[model samples]
Target: MSTPKPGKIAAQFMAHKREMRLSPAWKALRGNDKLVLERIEEEHMAHGGSTDSLPVTFTDFQEWGVRRAAIAESIARVEALGFVECVERGRPSRAEHRFPAKYRLTYAHGPKVRVTDDWRKVVDAEDAQRRIDEALAELQARTAALSGKLKKSAKQRAEDRALQARNAA
Candidate 1:
């Protein structure tokens, strides 16, 4: 599969938008399923993810005030229609313990067409990057707190020592 540049990715995303608008599978989706898919698409675009894959979190759907189980069912319905798929399971950070599954979607998944290799690569790359970014962000957050604790200024250190000495006296 070729590594598509940013421009090519944008073009592909536009094509996907066109295809999604006209796709029979998308049309067949129920109202809730359609809403979920649309939100996923919006998030994919917002995050610069490939048109074929989206990183969707439960929190992303939280704005709709929907139940988690209902959202899962909606996703299942979309997947059953071949309108979307969960490409990767999310790994949550220990601190926040929030993880959202990654999804892939395309008009090619319509009954009439097959997902091409190039599109698959785009989806895969987007999912991988999402995972990497999540891991890095978690690591940075964790280390940031630790680093702050380790870097005490001389005055702060002196103050702490003086307090300890006073307590002992």
Candidate 2:
């Protein structure tokens, strides 16, 4: 038996059948979500077909034509649908401390790993939509709460500065 070429292997892995294309989780993916998935797959392929710990940064997605604002949500949506899982959550801290998130495509198997088709759990379109909607809503709520807290802290700091100035005078 002969080993398949890299291109042939990648094409086979990336290709989906018509039935899979029509599946609820697959069909529910938006353009950005699909782009995010593709970008991750590209990264995986670049790393010699390693499925886990594939680092796909926001900038990478942006270069692939995904909007900056949509990148996080797209990642979340794909994750919610079980197409990928974040193994390490990246933090946007100081440049020295910054790290891109690492991901694993659930459907792709590595030498020692087995495929986990988590998307198969999604029963229908409505179920897939509901899962994505719920995850996004929760994310929005957390973002809003954090914004509120930040605003409160800023206001407190301003008041402290004003009081200090009055006392100095």
Candidate 3:
């Protein structure tokens, strides 16, 4: 094959060094987690390497083929693996204040920034998996607790309404 043009290659390709691809942390990433990280990296590249605060939304990841249900967990896994750092989490509370989550790729540094290779801390695939599992377990417990509280509050409201109706009668 003929030699490819540098400009075309640079414009079209996002490079992952062989070492990074071979790293335990990278190896331990599930498919969805890799997709999440790739979407974030694409956003960073689209911004011309300004890795400071790359905003990537759930919709963006979904568009890139990450399942809607898996997006949150996948993002969390990638962060836990140290491939990305969440600078600001998105809030969906109000339309006027709504914003996408911002992130920084740990291996890619912006201007005047040094690379923070957090993934290197993971000694092996098992270590990476352990960290992910622990994070997920904690998240699940917190979610369950919150769900219980919400159910209790809803039940209380219903009981209060019934009492109010009886008094009115």
lDDT of 2 by residue, 1-169 (tens): 6787865652425545465577799989999999998998788767766557888778899999999999889988998898888899876767577688999888765574446778888899889999999889977897799889999999999999999999999
* TM-score of candidate 2 versus the correct structure, residues matched by position: 0.79
**Which is better, 1 or 2, measured by TM-score?**
2
- Candidate 3 off by > 4 Å: 1-13, 112-114, 152-169
Per-model TM against the reference = 0.46, 0.79, 0.79
The residue-by-residue lDDT of candidate 1 on 34-131, one tens digit each, is 67877776665565553555678876776655466567657665665555667886655567566668777644333333464232322343453453
Q: How many residue pairs of model 2 clash at the backbone?
A: 0
Error of 2 at 15 (Å): 5.1
Local lDDT at 34 for model 2: 91
**Candidate 3 residue-wise lDDT at 8:** 61
Between candidates 1 and 2, the one scoring higher on lDDT is: 2
Superposition error at 95 for model 2 (Å) = 2.5
Candidate 1's TM-score reads 0.46
Candidate 1 lDDT at 90 equals 67
lDDT of each: 0.59, 0.83, 0.83
lDDT at 154, model 3: 100
